[model samples]
Target: MATLICEASGDWEKAKCVIKDCGSLKSVSDGSVSLDSSATTFGSTATVSCSVGYVPKAEKITCKESGVWEEAQCIIKDCGSLPSISDGSVRLDSTATTFGSTATVSCNIGYDPSVATIRCQASGAWDIAACTIKDCGTLPSISDGSMRLDSTTTTFGSTATVSCNIGYDPSVATIRCQASGAWDLAACTIKDCGTLPSISDGSVRLDSTTTTFGSTATVSCNVGYDPSVATIRCQASGAWDLAACTIKDCGTLPSISDGSVRLDSTTTTFGSTATVSCNVGYDPSVATIRCQASGAWDLAACTIKDCGTLPSISDGSMRLDSTTTTFGSTATVSYNVGYDPSVATIRCQASGAWDLAACTIKDCGTLPSISDGSVRLDSTTTTFGSTATVSCNVGYDPSVATIRCQASGAWDLAACTIKDCGTLPSISDGSVRLDSTTTTFGSTATVSCNVGYDPSVATIRCQASGAWDLAACTIKDCGTLPSISDGSMRLDSTTTTFGSTATVSCNVGYDPSVATIRCQASGAWDLAACTIKDCGTLPSISDGSVRLDSTTTTFGSTATVSCNVGYDPSVATIRCQASGAWD
Candidate 1:
């Protein structure tokens, strides 16, 4: 083989060898050459070259001119990169290595340490997509064994267990754990009745209940708890209910039925009095009574006693008080008892109940009768709702009374001065108002039209204050003007009709009083007109004077007359005398 001729130098000898011209070329004519490719070799230092797009593997290759070309070793290299760790936050999880070296992942403490060590894949990425997370086993409950998880999830459910701290009691909470594998966290609610439970004083409860952790558990009280206001509940988790029921409303005994009884109040208060009365044929044993501590009351237990023994005012009864009353009267019996206005009871005896109906109650005298307007009293002891109907002769307010009936069964007169005015009314014409100082159960009210009067629109009415709500006066007394019957003459009905009427009588105990009568035009009947003769004018009534029965008349009578009530008979008859003239 001949020596090769070199053309280039520097880095490596600029060499261009042609093995075809010289067989098995062994050497080059330049500096020593190195084999470019691993597949070639030469006997001595020879010029070598690498293929296009490839660099010599050894930086320097050799080729020999031996009539055979020296091989130029070439190799493809991979791009360099960093060893990736599973957690990018912990980039240095593996030892440093070459471009294609493999890396693995590791975890810090508190962690499973070896959950899933990530592997650096061929893509130079430590992908954790293939790793699985391990979850904690079902946690045991901390509260009473009543807690259960709905599902093994990291959330809550509809129902939950509410546990009170060691020293607490709570009502059943509003959450629970179902069969789903989830956690139900319920807010703990504690309840405790500040006072004991009860019943009588409206203070106790009969069947109060309580609850505990969410489970099947119930709470209850004895016959009556000291605190009726306290509330109790039960739990579904079988745990004691935690919350003590709070006071909501007072428990009330069923209402008692007596004569038109009126209960004093509708408040949460207990032991308020309710007075009872009877209708026409009915009779109440007692009246003017107060409610007992047990919410029970006696009828007509205030003034006169019907115990079959001598009556005494001071009994252990709650109704007995320093008030006047009138019991059954025999007229002849004197020393029995005085007129006890406090005696609230005026009812028929049991056997006589259906016989003679109860007499009409005078707001100031007796309870109203079947002939009179209706009455609605509250509880046998309570006067709050006590009401009486004093029907004017006619066309007057039925709710008006010369006096009103009180829980005490006492007739009360209007407090206003006698100016033909009715009860003091609270007018809300947005302007008109009453300027009178009246205070009392039956005090009357006086009102005038708005300062700027509107004659055609003057309307007035009085109502009771401090009532459960507002209520118009009961048993308005006879109006200044009398309402003539349909066929009768009238002075004046004077005011709005309250289904009231009045009974006028002449001076003669047996004589009938003649005056204009009125009624609410409704069921109001002028019972005020008696069944017989009326007395004549004041100055000329001869004793024992007899006239036709025209002086006395029934309701709805058509008679022209002008006469005051209770006058001696100048000429007795059914017709009323005009002024001093009797025709």
Candidate 2:
């Protein structure tokens, strides 16, 4: 028996082992190696193999009993050359391919490889599919806009552009196709501007509420105000253009001659008014001056005025205080003795007329004498509208105290008469007496009544109508006498005249309490002697009791009697008569 020991050399040192040589073995190259042990030494065989992607052909060797080995040869299996691909290319480890060899595939720019790697097979061919061009999916859709491309087919390194409609813009300008089989997309958005600016004393009007680029706004003011700016524009940078709207103002008002002006406000403004007023003795030509929209005031003026000539007077000399009869001028007039003018002075008015009425002269006659009174005048010679004072003697009085001169050239004597009294009148039942023989106005007369008569009025007087006021003295009469119980009276006469006396007497069996009565001057009777006397107590009874009807035994009273048990009665009843006695 022969033994074989295989040793590794060169790049195949890891596969070194003992084996028996088979004469039919071939070569190996970086792949699996095998041995045919049936034809080799028993229980001492060795083989060599190659790794993946390499072919191996083992060497045929012999082993001897003396522990020595013979050298052998190894060969590699061969595979064909690599094939070409459309729009692609292949790369191989060597130009001459072998078993278990590999080849890589790749595409051109903007292209992708379908198979990345391949290997050589034992049938002398490559284990790989054909390479194809890469494809990027369809381009993404853009919002509010659209994308522009050369073709619908999307490939690697291909570019597309994005665009927006009116009032819109794109987020990005352009996009490119990638090797990852996808295309990048850029979005689109709407363009906008910021809020609009505000204006003072005015308002803005816009075409629409939306504030955007290239928009316009118009400004306007209130009724009494005007705007400084009329229009404004919106800018592209999301902001509005600079604008200022203010109130319009007019300048100071003009001065007016001979007049003063009053303004609504210190500062002149649109629609304001200035009122013009003239001083004393002047007038305004225009009433008001108003501010207009053109920043100007209405024209106004003031003017002066004058009066005409003065009035003339009859029977009086006139004098002018000023050279001309202009406004605020005066004039005077004077009259002769015993004559007076109706007006004393005259003045000129601003309405071109004199302030004095027509003046006339008049005279007054001589003063009149009084009978029992004296008259005194303000002047010895009197004129119209003059006054005089009148007085009477110490015991007399005048009907009127003062008098005046009339327009008829005579004094007024209607209230200038002197007062006097006439003879005293007689009184009935009385004598009239006077203090003095001279009986005039305000004189009084005293009266004396006769005996037993009274005077109705105590005095009499003389009146200004020349009539005497008479007074009466009346005869006095007394009233009827008072009645006395159980008595009788007799008068001297039926008429109860003053100074008349009456006699009184009680009834039978009664005494007289008063003797006589008299009448007084006051129409009343004297009651001192008009009383009646009372009767004494009734007689007492012993056997039979007595019961008096009245408490006492006065006039017109009665008593009753009763007997005890079967005794005879002395009297049943007894009466007290008007004479104060019991019957």
Candidate 2, residues 446-517, lDDT tens digits: the string is: 888987788777777667665667678777888677777667778977878888888887766456565877
Best by TM-score: 2
Compose the digit string of candidate 1's lDDT tens values, residues 225-316. Answer: 23322444333333332333222333442444434656666643334555565653344665445544444554451222232222433311
TM-score of each: 0.19, 0.30
**Model 1 CA lDDT for position 523:** 26
How many backbone clashes are present in model 2? 23
Listing every candidate in turn, what is its Cα RMSD in Å to the true structure after a full C-alpha superposition?
Answer: 44.4, 40.7
